[model samples]
Target: MQLFAIGINYRTAPVALRERVVFPLEQIKSALQALNATWGSNGLSNPHAGLPAETAILSTCHRTEIYGAALTGNASSMQASMDAGYAQCAARWLSACRQIPFSELTPHLYTLPHSSAVRHVFRVASGLDSMVLGETQILGQLKAAARAALDAGALGAYLNRLFQHSFSAAKAVRGQTQIGAHSVSIASAAVRLAQRIFERLSSQRVLLIGAGSMIEVCAAHFAAQRPHALVIANRTIERSLKLAERTNGRAIALASLPARLHEFDIVVSCTASVLPIIGLGAVERALRARKRRPVLMVDLAMPRDIEAEVAQLQDVFLYTLDDLGAVVQKAHTQRQTAAIQAEAIIETRVERFMRWLDARRGAPAICKLHEEAHRLRSAALARAQQRLACGEDPKAVLEAFSYRLTHTLLHAPTRALTQAQDEERARLVQLFGISA
Candidate 1:
């Protein structure tokens, strides 16, 4: 099997297209299973019956990526075929699964095969490929993806090893380099943008929507400002309450947002909801209720917790992930040196992983070689046993066994050397490490 990756990310596609391919966290396992089923029969029976022997899907706000190993019997011989055939199949599968036009999606997709796939995953896990350089969240997201794939039975030996090494590479980069120095994550960027819109976060009423990791991070950042009041609203009251308790804030039902939207001066939302939770009409109502008081709204969700049209409001300031990208980019130059070091570390790990993968590909040949040796040894033992049974001298029987085993082991190589051309003979000699 050959490893490969196909996807579209912030650099290759906009949110409009990226959002279209998002496999929601709750849907990831099912989506992975579906992907496997699309390629081949699922379950324990005949796992390698399809093109995709292993697979994992990583869908975050900025990217939707699929990492997989194609079931090519002879991986080295089918490189060109696997590159085009597997990529096209994956692209079509994604298009069909997401109900997207193949033409529209293919233009933005990037298909990486073999070592390139390994290198790309390593860079991503190390945060060198993040919109915010050296950000650590993508590593967690990748771990979650691997876990999901494993649960779905879509993860195989190849991907399992790849992800583990990817994690190790990430840990090494973060520990050995200064890539995380002065890190500006999306959560912090949202806070920074809110600070710019409002004179002081301490005096503002902050409302956080959703109870996921992003919101939790945002809450921590905004909480550090000692906002006048912090409230977390979510569809799940228990989850919201837990997050609120951690941040020393209050929790409210998501349904209450429509009724109390005007209560907060700053609203930050990041949810998995497919549709906008806060619509333009809701914002308009909130604005009127507040008598056009300015509200700073930051949306960290992909489908967007806040509507795009809300940006048109005269007294409302709205920012999406794309808007926060610029704020995060400002810190990119500061970490360039660390990023360079991280890249070197990732390259080294990538080569190491490829070597392991190559060794793995030779496993069947190694198994066969061991089996042949065992057969020869057994056959030689049988002849020695027969001589012993015929009342031959024990020492003589042992000597005959040793001589036959040695001759048998050397017979193949001796015959090959005799039949080989001069160049081939030299190669065979070197292979056996035979002296002149």
Candidate 2:
């Protein structure tokens, strides 16, 4: 079996495509089970019958990817199988759960296999591949995905080791480099942008959509502003209430969003919904109801919670995650020193990981060498036992056995070297570093 990772991220695909593939936290275990069942039945199971090939998925606002191990004839076949499986599974799941089409989605996908996948995952964990460079949130997301895979029994030695090593590499990078030291995350940047729009954030009423970490973070930032009122609306009422309680805010059911939309001056949404929750009509209605009061809406959702057309509305300021790029750019220079240090650390860790991979690749050869030696020793001991059983002297039997076993082991190498040509003999001697 070989290890592979295949999928696209913020750099390779746009938000439209990334959001279509993002899996909700609650659905991860089932999705991993489905993926394992799909691939295992297709001849991707482990050769040793120890465990099924490992599978884990990391799906966040910025990226959607699968990391797995599969048995295949070659690298190309492995890549093809992975791409096909991801496209097929993602389409089916999204269509059934989110009402998205498979055909409409497949074209936007990107697949990276084997070494490239490893490199990409490492880069992502190290914060080099994030939409907001040096942002540390991806590491936690990766860890969460790994835990989901583990819970679903889709993780084994190969993947467990790979992810652990990847995490260590990320830690080393953070420890050695300034990569994350001065980085301002998207949540913080959103707050910064909101400040530009309103004179006092404390006077603004804020509505946060979705109860996930990103939204929770934005809520915390907004709460510090002491907004006139803080509200959380989530598809799941329990989760929404939990977040609302934490922030000293009120909770509203997602279904009531239309009725509650016009009451807020600032809205920040990051949800797992595959479709737009805040459409042009909703925003238009909200604006009309508010008598054209300005509303700053930041959509952190992939695929986007707020429709693109909402940005065209006169009194609406709709900003997606992409729009906050410039606001966070100033910190890039501040983080350069950290980034350089982190890269060097990652480089060292990468070499160590590659060495470990190489050693694992040579394990069979090492095992075979020990097996051959044990066989030779067992055979020699068996012959000596037979001689002793035949009433031979123990010392003589032992001497003969030792002589025969020593000769047997050295005879082949001696004969091969004796028969070697001048150049071949010299090469062999040099290879073994023999003085004579």
Candidate 3:
């Protein structure tokens, strides 16, 4: 079996492309179901169908990736076919779902195989691959993705172990190094950007456009400055109210935004909406209402909640993910020493995982041994039953049954040793853990 990861990330693609491929949280389970139907899962499927037996997806603002394992025999042809199946399946599935042609998407795509894929995931889970250096949010995103895949019944032994190892490696990285110290989450980074545009958050009003975790984190950071007013707007007023209550902000319906938009000096949004919520015209009207007072707008959502054209309006500093990347890059230099230490720890953990995988190479032999032993057990049980039916001594029957079962189990190894050549005897002895 071969493990593989295929997708686009911040390093490989711009935000424009990344947004186009994002798998929304609500859609992840269904997507995994469809993927598993085409790509087999839990080693149950028609061999004729070409698909990975196990899979998981990690979709975030900065990336969208498919991690999969192809379950097939060790034959070279089978291995090659399994490899081709998943790599193409991932690319074609993503392209078809997003309505982007493969030619247009392939340039930004990256395919990592086997250990390379494992290491990539481990690094990502540890926040090493995040756009914002050492951010903790991506770790939560990773866990969410894993949970969704598990709920979808798409995660099997290979993927389950892979993610577990990645989580452990991440813990090791955090425990052994200061890579996370003073880490600037995208939310925190957004706050810093807003600070640059305005003199003080205490003097300004802030409007949060979503009640999601990212927006909540941003709300907490901005709330710390004790803004003149903090308001949360959501499709569901109750959800917004919950968020607003946490930050001591007021909750408003998303429908109220246009009429009340001009009241805020800063707007931050991160939502799962597929279309732009804040259109250019709405922002223009809000800008006019403010008499062109500058408003800092941060769009943290993948696929974006704010229209791109709004960034062109004078006195409106619109920041999307790309702009946030620039803001977070400054702190990347300070984490270099800690990052180096984290890499070393990850390398050691990865090597340990690889060694465990190597030990699993003996699994087929172990399976065969158990199968044969089971046959012996069934045969011995049948004989004991016949003796009981024949009215053999009840106590003596039990002793004979135990003796028969033990002898049957040991017979094959004993016979094989008796028939073995001198050179093969040592190997047989080691195989059975025999002292001689």
Candidate 4:
């Protein structure tokens, strides 16, 4: 069995590059199905072909990663060559999925195999690898990814075990350590960006593009500032109105965004749209409407509710997940001790998880060996009992049984040794611990 992972994260690539690789939630299941086709739908590995039988993809604003396991019909039988080949295949799949050139993706990509891959996932789920250390959002993100792969029938035993272990490890990390004890940076990140763009957040008109939990969190933070005007917009006016009532802001339909886009000085969007909702053309028209007055835009969606091209507009300052991560990373210094404890917990869990994985790898061979031994023992015992029952001498029957059992046990090894070549003979002798 071989375990492999290939990915690029915020630490390795900037937001500009990250957005190009983001997988929309609606398309994740289909993407996984397409990638797993190389291996076959029945979840069996073809040793001659290096494609992975079990595969999953996790894509967030900060990272896009692929995790895979390839198990041969022969239990736990995988080679270094096979692992390396599959790693490259996974990378190519990611590149193709996002329509990015391999040459461009290679420099930023990180590929991990076996224990390293398992450890990487453990760290990610625990938030140790996140831009904001101990932020719990990553765990939710991972669960979402796992669900998508499972729904698509692209995930199986090896990956299933890996993710379940990850979840348990994360729980242990969070429960035993003070990793998430501190205040979260998520609520303040947008406000910080807004402040940077304008001299005073109080003077800016704020428009929040979604009424989900994320928008609620941001609304509270922005409400504390009491901006000049606060507006909530959603596909449904009722939901927006509820959120707007709390923030003492008014509600607007999402469709009204295009007409009134230029009215707001700050726009924060975190909708669940699969495609870009705020296009470059829309922002451009807004900029023209405002006579090129600067507007701060924070796009918190995974697939990006705001268009990437919007960042290029002269008067629009756009920030993505990676940008927000920078704002949160600074707060990590105060929680260094808690993070240290969490890392230690993760390390212990990672070792335990790897042991479980190793045991799984060895199971097929172990079962076969046990079964073969049991069959030989049963046959020998039956023959011995029959001879004794026929009134043959008891001692003779026992002796004969012992002789036959010994021969059966030694048969395979003796035959192998007899057929061995000069070099093979030396290795076989050492393997069986046979004296010279």
- List RMSD in Å for every model shown: 2.6, 3.9, 4.4, 5.0
Off by over 4 Å in 3: 40-51, 75-79, 370-436
How far out, in Å, is residue 370 in model 2?
Answer: 1.8
TM-score of each: 0.93, 0.85, 0.83, 0.81
How are the candidates ranked when ordered by lDDT, highest leading? 1, 3, 4, 2
- Name the candidate, 2 or 4, with the larger lDDT value: 4
Residue-level lDDT of model 2, residues 1-436, one tens digit each, is: 4576656666666666667677887788998887667655544354432223678889888777778765555556655665555445544554555455766655655666666666667888988888777888889989999899999898887788878888988887877776877678898898888899999988999999999889989988888889899999999999989999989999999999998899999999988776789888888888899999999999988768888888888888888776786677777887777777776776666677667766776788899977887889899999999999999999999999999889877776678779999998888788767775
* Residue-wise C-alpha lDDT for candidate 1, range 1-436, written one tens digit per residue: 6888889999998887888899887798888877777664322123233267789999999999999887666655446655546567678888998899999999999988789999999999999999999989999999999998998888989999999999999999999999999999999998888888888888999999999889999999999999999999999999999999999999999998999999999999988899999999999999999998999999889888788889999999988898899999998988999999999999899999999988988999999988998999999999999999999999999998999999998898899999999899999889999874
Worst 10 residues of 4 by lDDT: 73-82
List lDDT for all candidates, in order.
Answer: 0.89, 0.79, 0.85, 0.84
lDDT of 4 by residue, 398-424 (tens): 999999999999999999999999999
Best candidate (score: TM-score): 1
Residue 34 local lDDT, model 4: 78
RMSD of 1: 2.6
Best by lDDT: 1
Q: What is the lDDT of residue 69 in candidate 4?
A: 84
Answer with 3 or 4, whichever has the higher TM-score. Answer: 3
Task: Extract clashing residue pairs from model 4.
Answer: none
